[model samples]
Target: MDLKTASSLHRLRLVSAPEAVSFLLLLVCSVLKRTTEFNAVPVMGAIHGVLFVVYVLFWLDAWNRTRWSIGTAALYFLLSVLPLGGFYAERKLKAEAENAVIASRARAESAVKA
Candidate 1:
């Protein structure tokens, strides 16, 4: 992968953790609102909303930059809707990105020697 691809993947990974946390908070707040008088819904909703938007934007960027397969794209998209999916996405993306970097380096090294 090139620098742009690497950068886009990095941004997606960076946003994933916060997005997952916000989603969890939203879930907890919703439960709290139903179970008790405490209302954290508004704050949590706003936070999750912002994170979701950021995640989508980064997702799109990475999708455009990296030539991912349909299954890979589907997995990333599916994770957005499921609770705690962001964490899974983050882990998968980090490994993929690392692999991409290593592959790119290997290719470059071989090209230089050939």
Candidate 2:
């Protein structure tokens, strides 16, 4: 992958974990709101909403840059909705990006040799 594509993927990966964290926190806050006077749902909800938006935006950018298949794009989107899915998404994206970098480097090296 080129620098732009890689950077897009990096951006998505960066937000993935935080987004997942926010989602989990929001879930916890929901339970707390029901059981006690501690009401953090509004704050947590807003935070999670923002992160979810950012994740979607970054996902779109990455999809545009990488032209990922429909199934792959859907998987990422699904992960965002599921609890703790963002962490898995982040890991997968990291691995994919690393592999892309390695392959790109190898191609460059072979071209140089040729």
Candidate 3:
């Protein structure tokens, strides 16, 4: 794949797990707030918010470059909200990037032959 696609994918991959972790932390913070005196909400909330925005921006960039279908876009978007969704999205995105690389290589080989 081209550099732009590769970069966008890399960014998304890097952000995915952290985003998920932050989301899970946020959930835990919410529970802790209700059950105990713990108040990790502010810190975790800010972190999750930043990570979520980064995830969305990278996802949008990849979607625009990849020209993903509505279903695919929606799947990724929905997946971002779940506790483990980011991990799933990262896996799926990795597969997609691999496929893209293979396709790009095949096309290049065929063009060289022609």
lDDT of every predicted structure (CA atoms): 0.90, 0.98, 0.91
CA lDDT for candidate 1: 0.90
- The segments of candidate 1 whose C-alpha lies over 4 angstroms from its true place after superposition are none
Residue 72, model 1: lDDT of 85
lDDT of 1 at 113: 100
lDDT of 2 by residue, 1-114 (tens): 999999999999999999999999999999999999999999999999999999999999999999999999999999999998999999999999999999999999999999
When 2 and 3 are scored with TM-score, the better candidate is 2
Clashing pairs in 1: none
Worst 10 residues of 2 by lDDT: 25-34
lDDT tens readout by residue for model 3, 1-114: 798988888888889989999999999999999999999999999999999999999989988977889998999999999899999989988888888889999999999999
lDDT of 2: 0.98
- Lowest lDDT block of 10, candidate 1: 65-74
Query: 14, model 2: CA deviation in Å?
Result: 0.5
- Quality of model 3 by C-alpha lDDT: 0.91
Q: Estimate each model's TM-score.
A: 0.95, 0.99, 0.93
Q: Sorted by TM-score, highest first, which candidate order results?
A: 2, 1, 3
